[model samples]
Each structure stands twice: as C-alpha cells, then as structure tokens.
Target: MFLAFGFVMMLAGFHAESDEEHKVAANTAMVLSGVYAVLILLVYFAQATAVRLDSLGDEALRIIDYKRLGLFFSYDLLGYGVMSLATFFIGLTINAKSRSDKWLKGLLMVHGAFFIGCFLTPMLGVFNSKQSGVDWIGTLILEVWCCYFLPICILSYLHFANKSNK
Candidate 1:
C-alpha cells in the first residue's frame, strides 16, 4: 500500500509546474515511504518471530521486548503523520485547478489528527496495559484512515487527473 501510494505521489509530482517543487515532493514521498515500509516490515518480523518462539517455551516468548516493537510502531505512526502532511502540501500543487481540493484538504486534516492521536495515545499509557483497548482502537484508526481513506484520496486524484487530460 505504501509503495503504491508513494509511487503515485511521485508520478503526480512530475506534473508540478516547477522542477524544484517536483524534485522535493518526489524525493520526500519516496524517502518517507521507504522508511515507513522498512519499519512495518520490522514490526511484522518481530511479531512473527515472537509468535513462533511461543511454541518453544512460554518464557521465551514472554521475553520478547515489546518496547522495541512499540518504538517501531511509534515510528510508523510518525511516518504516516509526516507523509500525510507532505501529501497534503503536494496535493496543493497538483490539485490547484481541481474541484476536489477542498475535500482532499479536509481528508488530509482528519488523517493528520488520527496520526497524531496514534502517536500520543501510547505515550500517555492509554494503551499501557496489554488489556487496554486503546491499542486496538489506535490500530484500527490507523488502518482505516490510511489503508482505506488514503486510497479514496488517490482515486479522487486519479479522477481529476483524467478530467484534466480531457
């Protein structure tokens, strides 16, 4: 998902009027997406390894350092926040003539808010206990807002791009 979105954003950057702006947006989107992908892969690997270790001995799995996992998750959340902000700005450049700019701006703001909450909630111990539902809530918001909402934004961009080409 990250790769696809990042690729689309990079391609959109090429439509910018100025070379400098295009370079900045393309580079920023690529680097941010790459970092986010790496972080996600690390989290997945850690979780999978921890699950496998559970079969060996309960203690072995229990010893898995969740602090590290949490840190990577936090980084992923932060990356999403940054990416949303960058995309919003880039949207401004690519969507200047589009009627959907207002709607896109609103979506970006909402996405930013959730990303912020994802970052802060865990730090405040809102998800401190494993039993706390905050973790699940935060995760759900991240998935829906990014995985779902972002695709909608991308589609909207594509719609406008098609219209403009005509």
Candidate 2:
C-alpha cells in the first residue's frame, strides 16, 4: 500500500544519500524495508481477497482472516518488526547536522526497540485481537504507536526539507 511505497522510497533516498562509511548500514536498511513491504503487501492482499470468500475452508480462514487473530496478524507484527530494523539501520546512516536531525536519529534508533515486542509478542498470544475481551488492547496499542510515529514523520519531513535546502 501507500505506506509501504513511501517507506521504500524513503529508504531508497537514504541509501542513495548515505556516506561511504554508512553504505553498509543503508543497504541493510533498504533490504529490510523491502522485506517489510513484501510482508505487509502479502497480508493486505490475503485479507482483502481471501477473507471474503465463502468457499474458504476453516483452516484457510483461520490463517488469513483479519477479523480473526491469526497468521495475518502475526505477519503484520513481523512486517513492522522488519521495519523497525530498517529504521534502526537508517538511523545509523544519519549524520545529525542539527538539533532536529539529532532528535530524528535518536527517535529512529529508539524505535528499533519495537522489534523486540513485535517479534515475540505474537508467539506469546498477548496481542490476539479476537480472543474474547482483549480486542481493545490491539486498538490501544496501535493508537499509542501512531502517537509515537507522528513525531518521526514530522522530523523526517524536516530532514528531507533541510537536505533540499542544502
């Protein structure tokens, strides 16, 4: 989707602009972003198409239905975990020429920590959205995530704007 496209574009820009010393990190970020995009796209595609099928078997439904917490939900978490890795590597590539850039670098590096919960929580069954009364937990978690993510978007825009100015 658009999010994945924008993410890949941002990673590509970082990869292109990275200094020689940061080339490896940038490349790692770019590859991880690609994996994030692929995993996210696959989940979206499966949810949009297979979830509506009357002919889908019980086992198939168990895995792809977004209404139910299953494989697709796990894939969503895993994709974001991959994205966290991308952000961490991209953070390493930032040269931090200003206060804003420094904050951006710090946020990107700190955001990498989300990968820990994202990669492990699904296996722990703590995030299953439809498991009776815990539906609000998933919604609340995402809302909190958006709150954290909004600042990163603003700083990234500033970073790109300053780059163009320079």
Candidate 3:
C-alpha cells in the first residue's frame, strides 16, 4: 500500500509541467513520498520480523509496546508524519485544471496538516497516562483519517488515469 501511494505521488510529481517551480515542487514531493514508503516499510519489518509481540510480556518488550505506545508505534507514527508531509508537497504540484484536481489538491494539503498531530502527540506524553487503557480514541482517529483520505486517493488516481487516457 505504501509503495502504491509513493508511486502515485511520483506520478503526480511528473505530471506537473507548468514551470520550473512546479517541477521543483514535484521533485520534492516525489522524494518525500519515497521517504515515506521506505520509512513505513522499515516500520513493518521491525514489527513483523525484528520483534515478536506474542513472545514477550508487556514489561519485557519495548519494541512492540502498543499498549504503552512503544518504539515500533513511534516509528509507525513518524512514518505517517512523513507520509503527510509528502501529501502536502504533492498537493503543491496540483495546478487545479478542473474541479476534481482542485479537490484533490485541497484534500492533500489539508491531510498534510496531520503531520503536526501525528508527530507531536506521542512526544507530549498525551498517551502516557492511558498506558493501561485501550487506545480506542487513537484507533478511531486513524479510521476517520482513512475515510477522509480514501476519496483523495481515488480522485488522485482518476486524475492521473484521465490524464493518461488523453
């Protein structure tokens, strides 16, 4: 999924042809999106292969400490922050040739704002007190973000598909 997201961002970057400024913006977006992909892949690898959550007790595992918001969780959130920034930069490439493009660009930029919360929430110790509590709120927010993001992803694909058809 992260690879597909990165490729779409690269396509969006390459699609912008208005000016040198746009090209630079697109390049930046492409690089950031690539970074997002790599970061996420690492997060997945660390969780799935590097550490086995079932094998370790809550007190013993620092890597898979989802309950207390552990290392892998931080990496996951950080990867998402990178993804948000990539979206923001990719949003910059949108020239808004049509209403759909305009919507896509707007949603991407707004989604980028998620980086702030995703990056800072753990640092602020907001979830520290709830170590023993179920992180239903965080889970809900992520689901809501996915709901908001799916349309943007679909519109982005359509934008590129229409461009390719032409």
Candidate 4:
C-alpha cells in the first residue's frame, strides 16, 4: 500500500510539473499522501513488533492491541482518513484529458468522504470493543472502497503511460 501510494504521489508531482496553475494543489496532495504512508507504516511496524513482544506488560499490550478496537486500530483509521484527504487533493490537481482520467478524478475526490466517516466514527465509540457485526460492516465498506479504488489506480497508470508515449 505504501509503494502504491508513493507511485500515486509521483504521478501527482508529475502532473504538477506539467500544469503550473495547480502546482500548489498537487504538491499539497503529495505531502499529505506522504504523511499517510508514514503513519500507516509506523502503525504496521508497531503492530508487528512492539505489540507482539512478550516482555511488554498487560497494560501496554492493551494499548497497542491490534486484535480488537484499541489505540493502534485508531491510528490505522486515522492514517486511512488522512489518505482519503490526500486522494481528494490529488483529484483537485488533475486536469482530466480522457474518460479514464475523468473517472479517476471523480473517484479520488469522492473517496474523501471516507475521511469524514473514519474520523467521526471513532469518536462515537462504537468500535471500542470487538463487535462481530460492526466489524463486518467496516470490513464490507473497505472492500467496497477497494472495488472503487482499484479502477482508479489502473486508469491512473494508463493515463500516465499514454502521456509518456506522447
């Protein structure tokens, strides 16, 4: 996911270079996307290493717990929310030149809604504990998001590839 995001950021920077008018927007998008990547990676590392250590006490374990709703989970959610914002900004920077480009732009911008949901839902405290039903709903939403996002990634690749050929 981090690699994929880096690719997207690179493309955004490329677009910024091509269009002087939207350079600031594109740069801002890349910066936000970079933050998202860093945050996610740190959370992943913490989950894999710090969370798994036996030397850690019970209290510490609870704070870093990845199995149920906990601090790390919230961090993960926050990272994704930031990512959605980055995608929204990236969408703003785009000057669509083709059908695929238009779809990509629209999808990226629309994905920003995820930030609102993710940011707000945690505050509601519904995910404080592992509820099977609520967890499934969250999973379903992410799956649906992936379905929407994958096409945008493909279209972005095609758009950039075509541009390079010209």
Instruction: Judge candidate 4 at residue 56 and give its lDDT.
Output: 80
C-alpha lDDT of all candidate models, in order? 0.53, 0.86, 0.72, 0.74
Q: Per-residue lDDT for 124 in model 2?
A: 93
Local distance difference test, candidate 3? 0.72
Clashing pairs in 2: none
Order of the predicted models by TM-score, top scorer first = 2, 4, 3, 1
| lDDT for position 109 in model 1 | 43
Q: Write the per-residue lDDT of candidate 2 for residues 51-166, one digit (tens) a residue.
A: 66557888897787545667887899899899998999999999998999999899999989999998999999876655687656656767877888788889998889888998
lDDT of 3 by residue, 31-97 (tens): 7777777777877766676466457666546556555567667767777787787788778877797
Candidate 1: tens digits of C-alpha lDDT, residues 68-162: 23454555566556556445444434443455655654554454455566557657755443664443655565567657576545755575576
User: Which 10 successive residues of model 1 have the least lDDT summed?
Assistant: 60-69
Q: Which parts of model 2 have CA positions greater than 4 angstroms off?
A: 52-58, 128-131
Model number with the top TM-score: 2
**Please, what are the lDDT tens digits per residue for candidate 4 over residues 45-161?**
777787566578777776676555677777777888888887787788788878888898898899888899778877888685556655455466568877877887787778778
- Provide the TM-score for each candidate, comma-separated: 0.58, 0.90, 0.82, 0.83
Best by lDDT: 2
**RMSD in order of candidates:** 4.8, 1.9, 2.8, 2.5
**Stretch of 10 with least lDDT, candidate 3:** 9-18
